[model samples]
Target: MSHNGVQTESQRTALVVVAHHRTDSLTAHIGRRTVAQLEAAGYRIDFLDLHAEGFDPRMNIEDQPDWGNREKPYSDEAQAHMQRVLAADIVVAVFPVYWMSVPAVLKGWIDRVWNYGFAYGRSKPRLAGKRMLWLGLGGIAGDDAALPAMQEALDGQLNAGIAYYCGFSHSMVGLLPDAEERPQRLDAAGNLNIGDAISGIERDDHYVEFDRKAAGFVEEFLAADRVPA
Candidate 1:
């Protein structure tokens, strides 16, 4: 809670997971920007770069689900990851879209750390009050015909499939599009010509717009009503 009686970031920590292979990838760039924005909003951030940490996406027997044993201890790595989940008040994932869903590494993290007893298979959820936001970047244009389908698909997977199952109070997916825009376009004569995107100044302006859209998603998530069950 804050000095004004409203909940503030000082009292809440966000566990941010970035799933991308390269540190310099565009997905990682957006993830870093997100961390900066959240910090500027006063939230304490726990940044997890999965690839940099060398997290194994492969599952093993020790990490397998035990329906009868809610007390079954997972692998050492999984156990440590679970501890972080238990610690955070909010969770955020940043990744590139792969097959209209999360990458294998992120899904594997869920499969391993979000174990049966910890994330599900219990009467009361351990992550009951936590909230989540999934930031997915893709090369598809905003005006593309498949945009709605992509959005709906990602929403269902992140919000309904994972968040609800894990007992998150609220979950949202933000899709950042036009990631592969090119400056050259077909002219009236059907010949390619340099478009505004080729200009450095114009490209920067376009990115500013993209950043604004990305920030809007987080603003709404932060303002959401909290309904305790």
Candidate 2:
């Protein structure tokens, strides 16, 4: 692969999954940016726009796990998705943080595709040594008092509970708050507070900073792969 006119031997593939219904959403925009960055970094990108591809998150009988059979055959759709996962050296999931967690579609995608036999339920995990980055777009204000606790909760749920449990060598949750056009926060009494939306240069600057911060998260994630683990 070549990056910036420099030829290289690394040919890593990154499965960049975007779980947003609308193609014009901020989440989707960030997802596209992520793909571009990965490409520039010499990763062959297998971009999976779940909503556009009409991925049915609903679990069916064919995809259901049979605890007794660890090598059960899942639905064709599920198997196809699993193949993509298997082909990738790294996985980056970008989505809006709904209810302080991933959206229903993403959760269901995992429930169905990342099934017991495929992602887990074995002494030798298939996803072992793979890296994962979850870039969740959040609506909460950047300086909200609840931000720290929210980040901690998300880290525990996504990194510790799911990724590490599934045997991923490294997994990170890059929570990008201030995603909403109108700022939002929670008070000490747990009341929702919505602030005015910025316009003109303010809005432009806001998104500029947002993009920079988002890029920083992705860069940091990539840099970690170079370190000894």
Candidate 3:
């Protein structure tokens, strides 16, 4: 299952799911940038814009039943979304943090897509061996006061509860206050006025670095040849 002495094609595709309602923000730019980076790194990329795609995050009455033969029925739209997730070697979720959690659209995407049988609940999990990376944007500063709580939430609630529940190893990256706002250089006290700092950044290079970090993670994982633990 090797392609050019590396992982197979099936193992080099990364899914990029962006759950942003607003398209004009720096967060959206970062999301797009991430895709570009992974693509350039020779990994196939699948991008999902949950809102623009009209994804329904809410579960309906048909989802629950009592002791009967069950069918996992997804609309063509939903099936398309699920397939993208299924085919990926790695999954990247980019969204703005709201109230210390993912945006509703992203959360709903998880609730709907990561179903019982599809994402988990078999002797061998469906999403097993997959790795996940979370990219979050916060309106608050990236200091101890604002970041630690969010980091805990990501590690405990999202990573542990959601991703690890489905048998995926996870890593998270947070670009806070706005990617465009951070200072080009941090001060003596380690305080960064990110919004002011964004003005000096080279957007292209920034995206390149971000993508390299992400792709590097994927490459290391594949080289290790270990399933998700």
Candidate 4:
């Protein structure tokens, strides 16, 4: 299909999910930057800000899945979200990392919207060919010794555990550490170390590099989707 001289399939759709209470947060900033980059790459953006959209992260009876029934009916809200997921060729989730995993909102989104009958439980999965990118913001310092382990664990959870289980064709977790203005790391004794908050040109430079790294990740994700036929 073509619109305004544009091929609808060529100009694919990207569903960008942002899970943050405040729009001014670094997670939200990265989410916006992601949207801009995808848009510049000619993707039609369906930006979903979970908090701003009043998405209920708490699962209710209506959305609960029946273990025996793969064709179970879900709540209207969950159905709507499923439609959004179905419409997009790619999904980009931007959220803060909590306890080395995605925040509750994003996790609940998976629980509710990515339900058994919809995102899984079928021989031919509905989301099989879709791609996903998890952009997680972490407060831990980039220099932290545990950073690599954290990344590995998160990848195992988000990529191997969730996305692949749901049959997504590709998924990548783009971790953005050092998102806090105050430097945070762990000591040799496994104690949390906190440094003084940064300001002035230093703070500006900090976020500039952060955004640049985030943009690089988004670019890489876009490139991955454009693989040769």
* lDDT of model number 4: 0.90
Error in Å for residue 94 of model 1: 0.5
For residues 142-180, write the lDDT of model 1, one tens digit per residue.
666667888999999999999999899889999988665
lDDT of 4 by residue, 95-202 (tens): 999999988988999999999889999999999999999999999999999899889989999999999999999999999999999999999999998999999999
TM-score of the candidate numbered 1?
A: 0.86
What lDDT would candidate 1 get against the real structure? 0.82
Give per-residue CA lDDT, model 3, range 1-229, as digits (tens).
1122245535487788888878987668777877776765677767777887788888765443222433466556556666888888888888888877888888878876787667766668888878787777666653445567677877776778888888875554443443434533345687754444443357567546655654564455444434433
Each model's C-alpha lDDT? 0.82, 0.90, 0.67, 0.90
Superposition error at 5 for model 1 (Å): 20
For each candidate in turn, the TM-score is 0.86, 0.95, 0.72, 0.95
- The residue pairs that clash in candidate 4, if any, are none
Q: In candidate 3, where is summed lDDT lowest over 10 consecutive residues?
A: 1-10
Separately for all candidates shown, the number of backbone clashes (residues 3 or more apart, or on different chains) is: 0, 0, 6, 0
Q: After superposition, how far is residue 131 of candidate 4 from its true place, in Å?
A: 0.5
- For residue 169, model 4's alpha carbon misses the true position, in angstroms, by 0.7
